[model samples]
Target chain A: MSVLEIKNISKSFGTLDVIKDISFSVEKGQVVSVIGPSGSGKSTLLRCATMLEKVDSGYIAYGDNIMVSNDAAGRAKYSDKATLNKIKLSTGLIFQNFNLFPHLSVLRNITEAPVCVLKKDKNEARQTALELLDKMGLSDKADSYPCQLSGGQQQRVSIARALALDPEILFFDEPTSALDPELTGEILKVIRTLAEDNMTMVIVTHEMAFARDVSDHVIFMDGGYIVEQGEPNEIINNPSSERMRTFLKRIIEK
Target chain B: MDYSELLKVTGILLQYLLPTLKIFGYTLAFSIPLGMVVAMLKMCRFKPVSWITNIYILIMRGTPLMLQIITIYYAIPMIQTGGSDFFGGLFSGFDTRSDTYQFTALLIAFVLNYAAYFAEIFRGGIEAIAKGQHEAAFTLGFTKTQTFFRIILPQVVKRVLPASSNEVITLVKDTSLANVIAYAEIFRKAKEQMVFYSSLAPLFIAGVFYFVMNAVLTVVFNFIEKKLDYYQ
Candidate 1:
């Protein structure tokens, strides 16, 4: 079963249509990577899927719970609060800059939402947070603030923060785009481990090799639309579209 | 320049310190929460609610605070004369000549005036938080209120401390503005002592009180700033 389903979604910012009637879904326990240039609206696509940006028109659902659907007027209408809250609980997002709460300890950064929003017991939340931190190789840094950690460690803690809520699906908007090449490897390795463990994810990323290696499916987007998508090996190695061919060549030469 | 006389004046001024402390303490206690409320109201998405709060902040910020004190003191009883039975009865029971009425008027004026200033400071602090923080909290299923109090407010308190400390120190000095309504705080006592002593020493002694209060405030704020230093 598809854990997330988005169909016929379009989004515009003022006069520019950032996402022009795009549609996609992430099946359960699958890793889907969205790879594209900066202006390709891949980030906007992730934003729309994660509900950070509203859709102009679309149908989005997690499992059987519909998050956004077209109303009678053919405009996008989101689900009621309870349904939205349910969808929110089932998903997590990691950002390019690792937007961790600097005011909180690394442990609190992971546990606060679960304790306060999920109403989880404090000790249980702490236990789950510590385990997630341990998995992220950040066990010793639990009491440290985000600012005190290296970029890779900060991103790891953010991942732990998302995982502590036990999201069925996670979204990454250029998770390693802000890190050094060396640091990028750590994040990619962590992501690869998540994929190996069968955690469903949709990552909007720029790292071509990492995308090909970690994703079960690769989506190449350009000019506000998905230009080509298929199995990573086929799509990355042999492209039928001229745009995809040059796009891959340009990335490779860089 | 009689040193002993200066000491005597300081002693006299010390006796009236309670009223000044009351003004400062009461204003801080009431205005801060009221300021947070006003800040929220001013930032409200509802057009009319925000519009009214904007006008309120404008009027409060635009006028002189001394004038506000005088206006509130005299204008309160005028509600009785507005000839609405319900409104008139609100102030009808209190003897307008009593010290309680004067103190109430002083508090009302101080609280409202400072609330407007604190509201602007808080608003700036709140707006300074990055958009990504809210997004992070939202994806975790935090309700808007939870996101604000838990995620946003703690960060805001850190950002606004320096600015808020400025307001708080100013509030300490501003308590003397109570004298405009004949509510005898330290500055008022100093002025009376100056006239009686026929000397400037009493007024200089009053300066010591303000200096000491602000010095203590500076230390407190620095300590708070340090406590929050665990985060960037």
Candidate 2:
């Protein structure tokens, strides 16, 4: 089943049509990566799918739930906040900036959603957080603050935080874009591990090689449009569109 | 210079300390929560609410606290009784002109003034929190209220502490304004005793009281800041 389905979604910020009538979906266990130049709206698309940014017009569904649909007035309307809470539970998001709560310790960051939102027992949450921290190789730093960690570690902790909620589909908005080149590998490795476990994910990224390596499908976007999309090997290895050909050539050379 | 005279000065200042602390405690008790409410109102999505709170903050911050205390304490009684004795007739036995009423008015003014400064400080702390924090918390399925109380408020308290510590220190000293209406707080009592007994020791004793109280508060606030220093 499609874990997430978005159709005919259109969004604009102050007359700039950042996302112009885009549509896509991610099925269960599928890994999709969206690659685009700056201002191409890949992050905006990921945000819209995750419900962080309201869609100006379209349909977005998660499993059996339709999160957003047009109202009688032809304006996009979302399910009530109560229902959104349920939809939000099924999705998790990772940002390029790592967005961890600076005031919270590493342990608290991972357990907060589980305990506060999921209403899980504190002990169980801590146990789950410990296991995730161990998985991220951050068990030793569990008591450390986000500000104290390197960019790489903070992003890993954020990934752990997202996983703690046990979302059906996780979204990454250029998760490695903010890190040093050396640190990007650490974050990408974490995402690759998730993919190996068959966790469904939609990632917006600029790291073309990482996308080709980890994603089941790769989409090339430019000027707020998906220029080409296919299996990672086919799309990255051979491109049909002139724009995709030049774009891939330029990034590969750089 | 004698021990008995020193002890005598200490006793008189100590007796007035309770009233001084009474005003300080009440002002903080009322102002802290009121300040939070006002900061929320000032930052709320509604236009009118922010506007009203903005004007209120402006007026309170713009004016001197002593002026506000005098206006509230002196002006209200005249306004209440000057009209028709309507209030006087209604509550025949009670006097709005009494020392008790003046202290009440002083408290009201102090709360209003301090709440404004605190509201600004709180607003600064809250706004300083990165937008990403809220998004992350909400994306975790935490409700807005949960995000605020659990995720946002604690961080804000940490950020606002140094600023609030200054406000708090100033509040201790500003409590002396209570004497403008002759509420007989420690400073006022010291001044009265200085003239009545023809000795300056009461003034020195009052200074000691202010210093000791402020010293205790500084240590408490520093302790709180250190506890929060676990994070950046």
The TM-score leader among the candidates is: 1
Instruction: Give the TM-score of each candidate.
Output: 0.96, 0.94
Clashing pairs in 1: none
- For each candidate in turn, give its C-alpha RMSD to the true structure in angstroms: 1.8, 2.4
The 10 consecutive residues of candidate 2 chain A with the worst lDDT sum are: A18-27
Tell me model 2's lDDT, rounded to 2 decimals: 0.89
lDDT of model 2, residue B226: 92
> What interface Cα RMSD is found for model 2?
0.9
Scored against the native two-chain complex, candidate 1 gets a DockQ of 0.85
Clashes of 2: 0
lDDT of candidate 1 over B56-80, digit per residue (tens):
9999999989999999899878886
Least accurate 10 contiguous residues by lDDT in model 1 chain B: B90-99
Best of the candidates, DockQ: 1
lDDT of 1 by residue, A1-254 (tens): 68988899999999998988788888989999998888999999988888899999989999999999999999999999899889888998999998899988999999998899889999999999999988999889989989999999999999999998899999999999899989999999899989999999999988898889889999999999988999999999998899999998999898
Give the runs in model 2 whose Cα sits over 4 Å from its true position.
B1-6, B82-99, B197-200
lDDT of each: 0.91, 0.89
